[model samples]
Target: MLRAGEPGATGYREALEALCRAYWLPLYAYLRRRGCNCHQAEDYTQGFFARLFERQALVRADPTRGKFRSFLLAALKNFVADERDYAQASKRGGGARALPLDFGEAEARYALAPSDTLSPEEFFDRSWALAALQQAMAKLKAEYAEAGKEHLFERFKGSLQVDANVASYRDMAADVGMSAGAARVAVHRLRRRFRDLVRQEIAQTVSEPAEVDEEVNYLFAVLTASV
Candidate 1:
């Protein structure tokens, strides 16, 4: 995000574009909670990115102020509030080149708890935290795959957050063909590595490293609420 802070920087677009690709879902979820239908949410999500590029959002973005996710949410709010942009976004064809976001399963994936009704802002935070967790887990799985431990990751990932609910280490070790103590240590190390990966994921969006811990705490809080 430092690229966004730089004046006339070459990589700012790439940096923000990466963010757009990775986090479009949260924005979509926000729009949905704001009363948009599936198609409308998809349009607004893609339209925001299209307008983002058109307006040079990176130049106007100041990461020094706060987290990149906040900037995106605020910018998206502004975009949705504009009557002209809303009208334009609703159009099926207006020479608006769409961003390559896959919305095929967007509606299907959006399963809000029947008992839990959330405001748009709450929805955004919940979605944002979930997105970060998903990104972190994906990165961790990729790392494990590179190390020839993909199967282990799949088996142990369920126990990443809670150990008490899982089977005893002896049972897991017998299933995985490892000593019980080694299995316990392996899961311990996996949990530690996952924490580091999650922190790294949070660090990517903030200007200062100090903001990472706050963001991480907030992320978990938001996710826990959804549970």
Candidate 2:
């Protein structure tokens, strides 16, 4: 039922909402990394989403042009460039509105990696990928927790990151108190779940399901270049 290129149609609002939910964290991280203070970043992030509700912007979005993340980042860069001074302006009618933001978490994540060599576009894509992965992992962990396999999820999640010297299946199995076969199975399942989640994440922003692989490859390239 989720057709593309119909921003004013009955399902358009729902589709856009889903896209925002998937990308908000990455956009926030990009803003925070670009030297915006926590409050300014929060406002800008909220404002960016608010602008998407504009008929002009939504109706003009062309999925055929490529990845929605790219379109969004470009829009955000233009928005910031255009609104450079608005963040510091005094309010006329009342005190500044409180923009809802997860400042604590944003600050924590930013603090962990305060520097990067990637261009703004690359950084945005990298952040997008990370956010998508985080959301997918959270959902998977919750499912595991609900099924009384929280420990298993915890053990595997720790090793999801790519590393040149990653431990072997036998080593991880020993560390997690599971047999090598069981560890291998768990890791395989986790990888499959991660891939499915990534596809789902990409599908939300794209007009066509066939475009998922292309977006996924671009995401990997962005992450690689950023790192």
Candidate 3:
């Protein structure tokens, strides 16, 4: 996603930082799954970002090629392959201009992932999908908060992409101070908004607009795959 443009272009730095924030956990988890201990994995992940910035590796990306995640994972695998020592990386990683990660929270979240024999790549794909969904949801929630409809958002969030089946249209309509028809319309609008937000989120992780739906479907498949 951050690899969409030239290295020194406007907003490139911010884009890079955002991408790092969205993905560092998944990368760290992949490293851990590959047999790296916490400290080693942390070092490797940080150092990889550092290298990306320092070397401007993103400028080498060819948008016509493939998904951003695949490009990134390939780069990371190469980085790890070339690194001679984790101890040295840990020492140097302190000076790397990488995004800060809350290791405690990251490890706690990783602990909740199903531990049934998944490969590192499989785990990374699932984690990345979850992260993308979370970012979209957070953005949607913030939009409602800014509109002074935070409570309404909370009540209707379950209807963003599903019927929920917990309440009838009339029942939900009463809770939201709307008639059943209006409530149904509200639900339809929210689902469309959510779908647009998801598309936007997926678009950022791809090289082209046409790839967004393809990427979105792949991510959902990854999330649903057997652990």
Candidate 4:
């Protein structure tokens, strides 16, 4: 985040893009929960980011305030309130270049959200947690694909957060043509790698290295509540 906060610094744009990509869905989810239709939500999410860059919001962020997630939600609240007249959503983003957000699939994902029991903020946090898990899982898959082990990763991925009994490792071994013991060992390695990736995802939003574990716990709690 500090890297993103400094414009023209080495890696600044990369850092900013990473932040944008990770949180865009959560922000869109927030808008949807706040009663915006899909089109309004997409336009608002795009406009918020455009305004963020225009005003140098990142450069002015103070890590002392709180986690990046909270800061972003607060910023979004302000943006939404200020743009209450966003019937003009068409005009707002028509002139600014947009971010590479996956608005196409965003509504499909939002359709699977829990029934309207959660507040907008609660929904945003839940989406954020899920999104983090997704990003980590994708990165893990990509690593295995690059190593020519996509089949192995896919076979054991369900074991990443489970115990030694990932349904039936013996069956997995038979399918993958490996010994049962080898499958168990492979699953153990996959679980270890997945935990590392999850931790890395948590570490991104926090101001201090020590905050990752607490953030991870909070993320799980949000997911648990939704379930």
Candidate 5:
């Protein structure tokens, strides 16, 4: 049986860890793009995760009100507002409040350069969408691995992407030693599973179930805008 956000065996600690792993990059990127120096961004990002874990916020998350990304951003905004002064006042022995985060490297990887065409808000939205997709993919891969169909999953995983230019069903069937009809069915099932996994991933972040569609629409808009 799959144990996601269920009450029993939910293991709040484990779930929080997973959520941090999944969202830390997006949060970090958001902070960096907002003009925080690398060190401050890292500190803020780490502190955000620490606070989230300390508060057991995930236990009370309800996917019925809004998208998880919205909730997280709002929380992050509030955290920064509340902690800015305190964080700025505190300093290391060197007398620098900044924690010496490698913002340059982070910038190269996650931050958008001024020359980039996308606005900060657009960048954050796209980053959020990609992060959500990655989380969904990770869960799907784990499910396939657990079901002993890892090979099948790898064979068709590329087809899930919008711009994959995936192989024809006949070619996929030949590669997998399955009939063309089976290959078609397999791809359909794969898409269905991916959608379910993506929905579940988004669901875990929000406060209400109704927010899933809204989030999905926003994500798609981000993707579309990028292209």
Candidate 6:
């Protein structure tokens, strides 16, 4: 992402936009949990990214700060503190460029967040975890589609996380026209594949391959904590 921070770099703008698109929801949810209403939170989130990229604040990232996610949250908190008037700020004011963020969907998603007194940071962590899990699942589904097994994947995927004793292999077998034993095997393989994809997804966010496991554990911990 350092390229994204470079002035006048080719594709830097697109790279930064992609990054914002991926993480904006979590940031928006974080702001909401801090008591910003939907419109206020949307404005803050849009302004935050606009100012963040325009000022090239990404150049301030340091390995010592650890995960990029944590660094982002810290930067956002600093931005909000300094830009207290964001609630009234317009996209054109302060030369802030408008991004095409979908705040309507963002608010819809935020409405499903845990209501059990989670701190803003915890909510951000949970949102990040959910986003990563979603990306992994999307990738897994695409691979199944490529192999012409999308139907099978769909029928067996529910068992990937369900306890073997709780999941009905018989029902899945009937749905997929497979024997119960084959349905069990399909779920086993799909679960293994899904785990690998999740690890791969985590690998993208960390500084090193060694950090993937630690990040994975942290995200899963956040998920369980939310539950």
lDDT of each: 0.76, 0.69, 0.78, 0.81, 0.68, 0.77
Better of 2 and 3 by lDDT: 3
Most lDDT-accurate candidate = 4
Candidate 3 yields a Cα-based lDDT of 0.78
Instruction: Give TM-scores for every candidate, taking all chains together and pairing residue i with residue i.
Output: 0.88, 0.78, 0.89, 0.89, 0.73, 0.83
lDDT of 6 by residue, 75-109 (tens): 78877776767534653333354588777799888
Give the per-residue lDDT digits (tens) of candidate 4, residues 1-227.
45664566788667767887887999999999989888788888888888776654544455334587887888878777766666666676533555877787998899987786899989999999998899989999999999999999987887766665654888899989999999988888888888899888777777777888889999999999877
lDDT of 1 by residue, 132-198 (tens): 7788888899999999998888877767967733357777777788988888888898999988987
Q: Is candidate 1 or candidate 3 better by TM-score?
A: 3
Q: Alpha-carbon error at 184 in model 6, in Å?
A: 3.2
Candidate 2 per-residue C-alpha lDDT over 88-154 given as tens digits, one digit per residue, 9 for 90 to 100: 3222101233234565787787667537576655667777888877778778888889999888777
Clashing pairs in 4: none
Report how far off residue 51 is in candidate 6 (Å): 2.5
Residue-level lDDT for 89 in candidate 5: 24
- Model 4 TM-score (2 dp): 0.89
lDDT of 1 at 37: 83
List candidate 2 segments past 4 Å from native: 1-5, 63-65, 81-84, 87-99, 158-179
lDDT minimum window of 10 residues, candidate 3: 55-64
Off by over 4 Å in 6: 1-15, 63-65, 91-98, 165-167
Q: Which model is ahead, 5 or 6, in terms of TM-score?
A: 6
* Shift of residue 119 alpha carbon in model 3, Å: 0.9
